[model samples]
Target: MKYNLFISLFVISICSVLAEVYFEEKFKDDSWEKNWVYSKHPGKEFGKFVRTAGKFFNNEEEDKGIQTSEDARFYAISRKFKPFSNEGKDLVIQFTVKHEQDIDCGGGYVKVFDCSLKEEDLHGETPYLLMFGPDICGPGRKIVHAIINYNGKNNLIKKEIACKDGVYSHAYTFVIKPDNTYEILIDGEKVEGGDIEADWDLLPPKTIKDPDAKKPEDWDDRATIPDPDDKKPEDWDQPEHIPDPEATKPDDWDDEMDGEWEPPQIDNPDYKGEWSPKQIDNPNYKGEWVHPEIPNPEYKADPALYKKPEICAIGFDLWQVKSGTIFDNILITDDLEYAKEQLKNLKDKQEGEKKAKQALDDAAKEKKSDEKDDDSEEDEDAEEDDVKPVEEPEHDEL
Candidate 1:
């Protein structure tokens, strides 16, 4: 047992060492300018990406990230690198997004592209290999998308992953394996996962309901039937409601002034609803008719459906309504442990940032309260000034 454990550990170590990191960007310095490219296409009005401190933890000088500078504008920024494939290896894409402006409707997703991408022409129409991140629009759409491109079409995950809805930093991670399975993680905890073939429509369904098959006319699907011996009671012929015995007409009420007065209605105590026979087991019932299924003719199996042929570049291609979404700590690697380690290091910093943001928010609320009090006081003083103590009219006094 000890020898077998040692062998397994050795194999895992080797796999970890052999894992490749295609590219990574932390946006720590001016290096991001040269490493990244932004869209310059006209008529779209793309927003500028700026490197600055996050909106919440402005005091934390060390924390910096790229944020959109304008609101209600398109954003398309990408970085190019050597093209690599995740055909037989695990592909992990992890990134962080902080919407400090309390975004009402916008996208905070990133896309991985093929080598033929034109950075300047990147827009909504641009094709991509994968897109993963939070996309919120009002209350109806609060989803973290895990979309993958297959054969020229993109398939969205069948399962809905709820996104963290607030002004805090959230880490989104997507992992695709060679076995045609994928997992989605938020803040290093797996949220949703399933087989790629089952969760996405990358290919036609293997089996379909046979269209020609139908239930026979004599098939019985009822679970229960009326008891043949059950009969309505002879005394169950009472009306549902009757006139109240206690209600009386007033003596002063004129017959001509008011229409004929009637006693108020009261529920009949002995009345029961329409009587029916009791139900019993259906004698001839076999089962519910299930439509037969057969192999779909359009289904052509593709073993490489889960494999992303080339993931050469990745960048933010989104729009923001309230602007102030800081994106940072991006890491793309096949090593899941390395991604976890990076996330672990961020926990401490993110906690401190959260506390700092709360403090600022509390201070702003206090200031706003004070301002409201001062305004109320000013309004009282203005009212006093407007009242010239009702000047006594000399003529009226005489």
Candidate 2:
């Protein structure tokens, strides 16, 4: 049994290593510009991208990626790969993003477009097969967008997935399976997953309320009703407000000169609110009348909801209020296990960034402390000089 288990583990490892990868971009160097095209579309201020690992990173060269260089501008850049369809396999989109600017309002997402999309023509209006990543605006709108194009319409995922809002690198993974189910991951942890149909309006529901079915005329759906036998108490009714006995009218000159004086009204202590008959278990209550459901005639089963016929291009077509978001390690593949393996180093990247940042912070704090010490010593010397008795002329003292 142990031998069989060992063989099984070996096979799984081999399969994971051999998983297919359709496209990947690490932006290792300036050569990335050769493959990525910038948008030249009219009537917009397009931002440029710089190759950098930013202020902190695990490995300088390995962590380097394309960073947005300008603020309050539109950025549209895309790279085209060999067209491929995820017909009978899982579609995995994984990438790492660092909002080094502590972005206030921006999109750190990538849009996946089909082969028909021109690299130069990519823009906000361009239709895409899938759009997945973090989008944040102010404090309330920090969320990961999982939008899929279905039958010429783009449907957004109804669920809200909170995104990492810090100034460190975070990995976002979206996996769509052939069975019309999906999984969303952040930093190698599963955050959300479910049936695509349930999460998005990709297809009409299989069953719907029957329009022909109607509630009977005598159907009593109320679970509770006022008891006819129980009447309101005689003193249950009371005015909501009453004149304050302690409040006396001001002793003024004459009623003719000024408005008539009256005591101010206050909340009545004896008030019992509005009077109503007590409720009891409803007789002949039928609970809720649920409409019978039938198989929707307009609904059709789509086994290909997961298919994107020709995904060939991936792009960043977004607007940013504050830029300096570095996008790196983008991967589009049909292998879930491979995508998982690729993201295994995400935690290390984040921890490395944290360590680097902490070092910088420590250095700054030490510098401040040293300056304070120097100031204190200088102040003490000045005090000593001030207190030192003036060397009066000895002859004058004599």
Where in model 2 is the C-alpha error above 4 Å? 1-13, 246-266, 367-398
In angstroms, give how far residue 242 of model 2 lies from its true place: 3.7
Tens-digit lDDT string for candidate 2 (202-303): 999899999999999999988899989888888888898999999876776467887687778999999998777888988889989999999999999888
Question: How much lDDT does each candidate structure score?
Answer: 0.87, 0.91
Q: What TM-score would candidate 2 get against the native? A: 0.86
Q: Which tens-of-lDDT digit does each residue in 154-255 have in candidate 1?
A: 889988889988887778899998888888999999999989988998889999999999999999999999999998999998999999999999998788
lDDT at 96, model 1: 85
State in Å the error of residue 235, model 1. Answer: 3.0
Best by lDDT, which number?
A: 2
Model 2's C-alpha root-mean-square deviation from the true structure amounts to 3.7
Clashes of each: 0, 0
By summed lDDT, which 10 consecutive residues of candidate 1 come out lowest? Answer: 54-63
Q: How close is every model to the real structure, measured as TM-score?
A: 0.84, 0.86
**Candidate 2 at residue 348, lDDT?**
86
